[model samples]
Target: MADPLPTSLPQDTAPPPPGIGQLFLGFLSVAVVAFGGVLPIARRALVERHRWLTPDEFTELVGLAQFLPGPNIVNLSVIVGARFRGIPGALAAFLGLTAVPAVGVVLAGMVFSRYGDVTAVADMLAGLAAAAAGLVLAMAARMAEPLWRRPQAHAILIALLAFVGIVATPVSLPVLMLTLGPVSILLAWWAQRGRP
Candidate 1:
């Protein structure tokens, strides 16, 4: 008889390590063109272009990044870079990701400090902020697709609870993290226990 399909999802195979030069140039490209946010571009490069991480892996990495203290993309760069090439990889990714943006921000700051008070400049800045927010929201929706495909309902519930816990309620982030983090893990584990 043919063997039955496994109940649990198969673990993704790790791909070959990208060289430090590729890491630097990939992040440099992401940094240069990413206007509203870097996460989307980073995802495209790491998961889609290079095939370094699968979609599910990318989502998990992003989740871990969100829980950490640093900026999400920065933390992601460090984790992904280190995963592929250790500390030197981490440094290369971090520097490549931030270097150009840092310079741009400094120059923008200099100009804004001079012209920011103007009504036209203020309006333009407001528009940019709105556009950035939209980009982030769109990226979030795209990332949520993997979770939406899971068989368990609690996966979606946990996500909704997290959203409401942070946005609708007055509860602090640290408290929510402490409370929800374990609960989510336990639920996932419980759901997976029935699988072969």
Candidate 2:
């Protein structure tokens, strides 16, 4: 008789790392499909569809990307690409993510310059803005879901503190990052040290 099928695959059997072409095409598809915000779709593609990064990994990279100089998603693409195949991968992903969008923006600018005053154009822009906000919220919830499932109270506390500090108080982003970023890192280190 044939051996019974295994219930679970071994940890060593993780999916093979994606090629540079795959990275380029993946980000290209994300750019094409995402209407108002690319991050939500990017997260879905990277974490769920491609399985290129886990939810926690995506959250961590995005967190780091936010503190970088340029746009967060751009930085994320570069980082993700570099993590896999160094500079070439980064270049491919960056081009795929920005090439189409950059052209679209130029065309859109010309159209808006001509018809910007039209009521329909204004309404459409407003609707796009609202949709962008909703996409951001949805992405936030998905990123937080993994943290909620895990026992990471310190991380949650830090998140809440950052939220309150930004919304309720006058602290700026730099101040919060400088102060709380190290604290969170230390707490994470402490938590990890307890493990075997």
Which has the greatest TM-score?
A: 2
Which prediction has the highest lDDT against the true structure? 2
Per-model RMSD to reference: 6.7, 2.8
User: Which ten contiguous residues of candidate 1 have the minimum total lDDT?
Assistant: 8-17
lDDT by residue (32-131, candidate 1, tens digit) is 9899788989989998888888888999999888888889999999988898889999998898899999999999999999998999999998999998
TM-score of 1: 0.89
TM-score of each: 0.89, 0.89
| Alpha-carbon lDDT, every model | 0.88, 0.90
Worst ten in a row by lDDT for model 2: 9-18
List clashing residue pairs in candidate 1: none
In candidate 2 the C-alpha lDDT for residue 13 amounts to 62
